[model samples]
Target: MSEPLYHVSANPHVRDNGSTQKIMLDVIIALLPATIFGIYIFGAPAAKTIVITIVTCVAAEYIYQKLMKQPVTISDMSAALTGLLLALNLPPEVPFWLPIIGGVFAIIVVKQLFGGLGQNFMNPALGARCFLLISFAARMSAFTYDGVTTATPLASLKAGESVDVLRMFEGFIPGTIGETSAILLIIGGIYLVARKVISPIIPCVYIATVAVFVTLFGGHGVDIQYIAAHLFGGGLMLGAIFMATDYVTSPITNKGKVIYGIVLGILTGLFRLFGPMAEGVSYSIIIANILVPLIEKVTMPTPFGIVKGGKSNE
Candidate 1:
């Protein structure tokens, strides 16, 4: 009798490295420094706001998924990250309930409604932020901390007033918790970049483009150095590094990434200069998110040896 032939079937493939859980964990770790800095700058209220935002976001995600009969994904920590980011983007003195509402919008509407994980069209936290900005402009614009109200860096800059560069770096300014200190945000961003958690293309190109645009305009007797200051002020670093680089919302192709970055920068500059609001990072990123698919299609690489009609080689 002939020996039976032996064959190994390779059908299903499974990939295991780090999960969404792990990636989210790393992101949370990367954000820790800024969180600590925020607490230090804004004191106990900042901590309270952070906690409330996180709990509300997680609760919203859990409730929404449970209601839809989808397996609750809170273990992935994505909701927590979204909550943390939303909190960071908010004024330290914001009412506690506002972030809860934003979180509901983020997890329920922007994230899960379109399909959970990997399927959302835009960054949930940023989308929620944009929504909140439009819905509650008064609350969003009322900047305060520890009972002291002040204009944001962008507002001051636009008003032809000056900011103390040293104080801004030290997080003494009144703005969003994680956005006030350019130095701390850069440090955290660098760590994320070094860990290969995020690409530098967006942040570097975005900031540079803004700098160039502001320089070219040269309005109100602002110089290049002043333009540079604007680059580090407000939420530019946070949005460029975190929100704009959101994997699901950003372009996949290299050329597309550059286009995305450039467009965001230009829009941010235009809004800062001409729009009613002084800060524009959230709006700019959301706009870029909306265009990512189109950008990817336009910038897609040509398929090898394939003509428009799929003609064969001559």
Candidate 2:
């Protein structure tokens, strides 16, 4: 007979010009600037970590699908994207095996075990980053440049110390692989938005909310420089623009996305100002991802001019 069919969505015509492979390729291309800039600053170790992570993630998916008799999806590039995102979130000086383990966890535990891809509740790469961060806090927090270790700008900011604002904007500040460069991250985000790969709603509102929150809750009387530091420092730019915008994990409707962005900003601000962490973008995004279903449910659109009982506008 006939072969079986797999269905993905009711709205089949969306992204008409884009296949999974193609969309993923766009994401990779958009992400390249920050990744390359990161490597340029961090050197061979960063490149090696990224390569190992990507290889391990792809291999994990291949092996899992092969053993389980599932369709092989390595060519879709999701696994590679997860690997790249996870590697970028890692400390540049992280051990070689760190990304290897993180890659496996991202593909096997976070993605595949949850039925893969859009089925997963959270972003696979981010989930893996939090997992590794918890399991290897020391390694994850350690940052080095030119054989000297230093705290990230966020950490220094938390300690009530001054940071080189200009350097932080220029990506010379100490941070994770892809998070140091605000300008490059914004450029990548703009590329995705311009290409219609993503909507600008979430990122705009998320960053705006954070800006307003820090301004209102200013520790030193709410200056523009402090706000900019909070904006460009740590992973706020990366998380707001990229990680929090994951299609599978974020809200679908425009109204739902607005609520999601607001919640993320509030949580991130709370965590940074009150919680014991120097930065809270990862936790904020994860929390927002978990609540996407609720937000969408509440903000779901009604059929045009119709009531709850399906009555017409008459």
Candidate 3:
């Protein structure tokens, strides 16, 4: 027989030059404005938290990979990204050891133990945040701005106290290190969309859904300040723009993505309005992450030549 010239791979026959490192670098770049602003606003403590968390995450990944005889992938920057995300979620006033503990749990337990990177069932940073939030509620909930302890705008709103919407929008209010600035976070989200790193559907839908939910059921009857407080006064923008859109944890198809956004929006609205906590972004995103598989399964497109019930049309 004549020698064959064609070659076939198992699947994913087409590929692109884009890499995990490049994508992570782009995300890191997108996050810089908020990160720098946070450091400038919170001073050395924020910087310290960021540095320790990132280093701990990177080191944990490196050591674990080495010990397991796996190829070291610390250079990929996923661990660094996870650490940065976790630190941003934390109050800058947290003890130095907190981020270290968070980083270790994020990398070793939520990430590596689950098979690392794409294999993780949830965002590692968020998993760690929830873990820390439950374990150290007081520390995690404390907020400070300009060295003075204060209630976050969301907390004030939850307590029926008037909040300075302008300050919250401008990120001058006390909150987590990175989540205070709505404008800066929006800018970063815009950059991500421009780079095609993420789609705008989830964010837009998620935000819109929250706005409508709060407006209809908030008992404020279209009060702009109340809506604005719910929107810009918490971690909603940060979570919607960055964490909830995580590629591995989010839905892959457009339909699935839209459904995912709705679920996130409703869950967040429920938690913030009815749950004991004033903030719900982290919990909402993590919960939605766990539902991504079901979303994708239902929204998966039928094959070109296949029918709805798996019968061939050809």
Candidate 4:
């Protein structure tokens, strides 16, 4: 018999032109608008945090890989993305060293220690944000805008004070660097969806779930301002659109994604309404990320020619 012309060796024989570097670059590009706006609004402090955090993340990853004798992958831009996200989540007035600590923790502890990028169980940025929040509660909760220390829009809402919903939507309110601008975040999210870098399922469903949850249990009956505040305030938009939709941490199947979104929405609502803190998006998404495995297992589709109970066609 003649030799075969070709050989198939693995299940993942299908391939595409997409690369990790390309996807990361696309995300970074999409984030640029919000990043620039954040810097513009927050001034040199924001710029400093962003620059330092990104550098620290890339440096941490490179140094770790070099020390471990692994192939250095800083060019992939995942570390940079992680740093940017962590910095964006930080308070603009945070000490310069905060992002440095966060970047190192995100890359080394949450990401590389778990076997690097795709193997990270939870979103590294969120995980590190949670860590920083726990370690620096007062610092993380402090907010300043326009050279004055003040409560965030969500905090005002929690304190039974009404806020300018329009201003909040317009990102004029005090909050984290990147999360204040609903319009810009949504624009970035739309760009990501148009580029097909992410599915709209998680972000759309997650936001919708939060809207519905807050409307029902928020003690405000069909109030547009209240619902919009919940939607636009805090880190909900940023986390839902960016971190929750992360490819490695989010569920793969459509069914799993829906369930994950619902879980995130409910948890966020619970935390915001009843917990000690007014913000909950980070914790909610991190919790849901931990549940991705079980969600995928339950929502896994059956193979072709396989019956429900695993009986095959005769």
lDDT of each: 0.82, 0.89, 0.91, 0.90
Which portions of model 4 miss their true places by more than 4 Å? Answer: 1-15, 308-313
| Model 3 quality (TM-score) | 0.95
Predictions: Cα RMSD each: 4.5, 2.8, 2.5, 2.6
- lDDT comparison, 1 vs 3, better candidate: 3
Clash tally, candidates in order: 0, 0, 0, 0
Tens digits of per-residue lDDT, candidate 1, 1-314, equal 89999865321111446567777887888888889989898887789878888898899989988888888889989899999999898877778788888989988899888887777888888888888888988888887755788788778888888867677766777888788877778888888788777778888889888888787774844574587668878899889887887878887677888889999999999998878778889989988888988998889877887766668555
Most accurate candidate by lDDT = 3
The digit string of per-residue lDDT tens for model 3 on 1-314 reads 99989875331111457777888898999999999999989989999999999999999999999999998989989999999999999999799999999999999999999888888889999999999999999999989988799999988898999998888888888989999999999999999999888899999999989999999888898999999899997899999999998988999789998999999999999999998989999999999999999999999999999999999999
Model 4, residue 76: C-alpha shift (Å): 0.5
Report RMSD for candidate 4: 2.6
In candidate 3, where is summed lDDT lowest over 10 consecutive residues? 8-17
Ranking by TM-score: 3, 4, 2, 1
Model 3 pairs whose backbones collide: none
Candidate 4, residues 1-314, lDDT tens digits: the string is 99879874421111458778888888888888878988888899989989999999999999999999999999989899999999899989899888999999999999999899778899999999999999989999988899898999998899999889898888988889899999999999999999888889999999999899989999997999999999999999999999999988988889999999999999999999988888999999999988999999899999999978899965
lDDT of 2 by residue, 1-314 (tens): 99999876622134576887887888899889999999999999899999999999999999999999999999989899999999889988898999999999999998899888778888888899999989999999999877689888888988999888878888987889999999999999999999898899999999999999988885766788888899999898888888898888998899998999999999989998888988899989998999988998788888888977678886
